[model samples]
Target: MASPQPVDIPSSILIIGSGVFGLATVYSLCKNPLFKDTRITLVDRQPFPTPDGSSIDSSRIVRADYASPPYARLATLAQTHWRTTFAPSYYHETGLCITASGPEQKYVPSSLANVQALGTDRVEVLTSSDDIRRICGLEGGAPGSGNTGYVNWSSGWADAEGSMRWLRGEVEKLKRVEFVTATVSQLLIDHTTQTVSGARIKNNSSTSTTTLTADLTILAAGAWTPSLLDLRGIATATGQVLVYLPISATEQTALQSHPTLLNLSTGLFMIPPSNRLLKVARHGHGYTNPTTIPHPESPSGDAITVSLPYTHIDNPSQSVPLEGQRSTRTFLEQIHPSLATRPFAKSRICWYTDTRSGDFLISYHPQYKGLFVATGGAGHAFKFLPVIGDSIVECVLGRTPEDFKGKWEWPAERVPEESWEGDGSRGGPVGMVLSEEIAKTTSKL
Candidate 1:
């Protein structure tokens, strides 16, 4: 067997967005032996520490307690990459704690079985409520009794900003990579040829606009992805928010020692912070179009006043106040009465780019050739950025990726009929193959 020849691609590639996805993609591309000689330029509206930027938030937890095998495999691969390529101090593997109550709890068993079938050795299904208490210190448990528990040792938290800083540093070290502060205004597509040649970007100050040409362009603008694609007639769903709060000092101590906790009954997860704060947020719900909502130039003030439904509570559709921190505190108090008195240190709003099918819409535009769109992260997509970057790079290079078929397949249905389950297996079949390839390729570095 002969080795695959290195691809001598174009010298320049332009990436729009400086969030985790964009940054990770640029880092991976620069590191790839095939693109070692390629020059990469990343443009974003905000500066490096993008204020209120989705990627550089206070803290983000990483885990592998997915209901599906594909996600589990991706998480396993990403975790290994983060630990090996990035500093160990950047990530904390406290593990993951998942619990289910009432009829909703049935999903847990099937989810566990799926991962086990994939031969993942990181998960352990706890038999008794006592086991949950012993491992996670949470006292609630019952079959259809609003209580059930499971543990995954491969789950934990990572310093999101720290990770980005490390990645950006690496990318900057490459003589071929450059970062620019600007907003991409228009994608220059050759209509007759059906190919994207470059982009015209307006600086944040709006005093000047410049055009940069590239052989390929990638859209990783997070929540803004849909709007950008809209100019090209591609429709995308706006993703919702995940709010986090801090627990009491005592409870915080226990939770810090505890694994990342996900209560299926409430559709909420508690992530321990590396800096001693606790994060709680809801998962799987879609958000209204952010374009309809006001864009807050600043992260402070009235800009944060968007209404959010309390999906984690007993009532799924009930409307309530959008108290990012207060809601988190109240939910924690209900689950573990002990946290009622703890003062909230802070709160944050995170956004996800959703798709109609509840899966990521990472594919090439049917009409716009050479213009790759990576949106619809659906909510749990952050953990898969490393491999997702690999896939995106492959797509831009016009190579058939093992994971592309499954990812680009358009679903007949607009949105998933059922509620989004976090049991992990969302990535289409052939997930293991893609995951293994990513691990093998990335592990070499």
Candidate 2:
């Protein structure tokens, strides 16, 4: 399908999904005097700041350590805004300590240099095992064990749920944007015009379906983007496990000063304790819900709450899978043995819409005019929050920056099979493809 030609700035915009990207788009558009009259309606399957949305997580990393220059620049911009405007509660500049073993450490020097190149003095190199221990409070630091990486004071983590809620509150205050609690069933398309007119949404409360009309529509549905737009090849939903350990008072005090630690070799990233809870997550090859079933325990008898549609199981009870729990325990045992045996405070399977390239997909649909996609985070778009919406605005106005022009466009095909194989954070091997019955019967693995 040929890419649809651009049209004039839209006066009526319908945005599906109110996660970071959707809220950011609303903020960006509403702030512009030129779009002061634009009517923006944002809809989500759940309520504002949906708990299951990838953007609505416990915490997200805020850093300027990307090996890619454009991303590095974007992170630097977002980091600055986060520190200045979002400092008090939402953003925490606890610092980030990233370690990679030999050979894989190629990105380490460049990552440090990238941050420094941003004209900041926040980067600190840890030269020895003791430096790692004293600076980050992680154990067993040897050459390449984590002692070799640097710590950047400017980089840290943000309270993701808080940040999204804050943004949603601000967006709600805007007169131009209306937040609707609804699920988008399908895109409203004008075949003759070859344009997406709007969307068909089901009100969560009223249970009534309404076709919302708009001059343009933006799909910022996060991990559910592929399911909404059939973007299987270009993007796929993958789930990552997050396990939280409730730390003791003493352990919490000792960890209060520790920075977020990321191990390149193991793809494990650990965030410092916040409210006595510490989070540890793996970066590669997360799971996904390709199929779904109704939850037997759902208050709404027919509510489908499973993460994947491919799964036949309709169980609603939530817990970390055995695999995830094992990984979390093993990593903690290696680095912080004291916290290894602590009971899990909570666990969740966070989903990410990963693209072949770790770059986000923000573009116009090739077959549908007026449909703009602002998804494919590849699990790392949160740090770019401050600037992402502006970029989307630019895309709508045909002013996408040269740096992002090709990088965020849809790939010609699903990433080549070999390339899709886990390459660090880009994600790992494809997960099991279960049958319908298997999906229904399968419990926590």
lDDT of each: 0.59, 0.73
TM-scores, each model vs. reference: 0.77, 0.88
lDDT of 1 by residue, 168-241 (tens): 77777876777888878767767677678778888777678888788767777876664455421123333233
Rate residue 356 of model 1 by lDDT. 40
Cα lDDT tens digits for candidate 2, 1-445: 2264665778899988888788888889988776877888888888766767778877899898887788888888887789788434788888998776545556677787888888778788876657766778776554324557789988889888888888777776776777778778777766677778888888777868988889989999887765556565677777777888887788878886779888665667788777888888877676655555333222243534333322112334665566667777877887787778888987776777777776788888887778888988887888877778888888777776798767787666665423663324322224633233234445533
- Per-candidate clash tally: 14, 16
Candidate 1, overall lDDT? 0.59
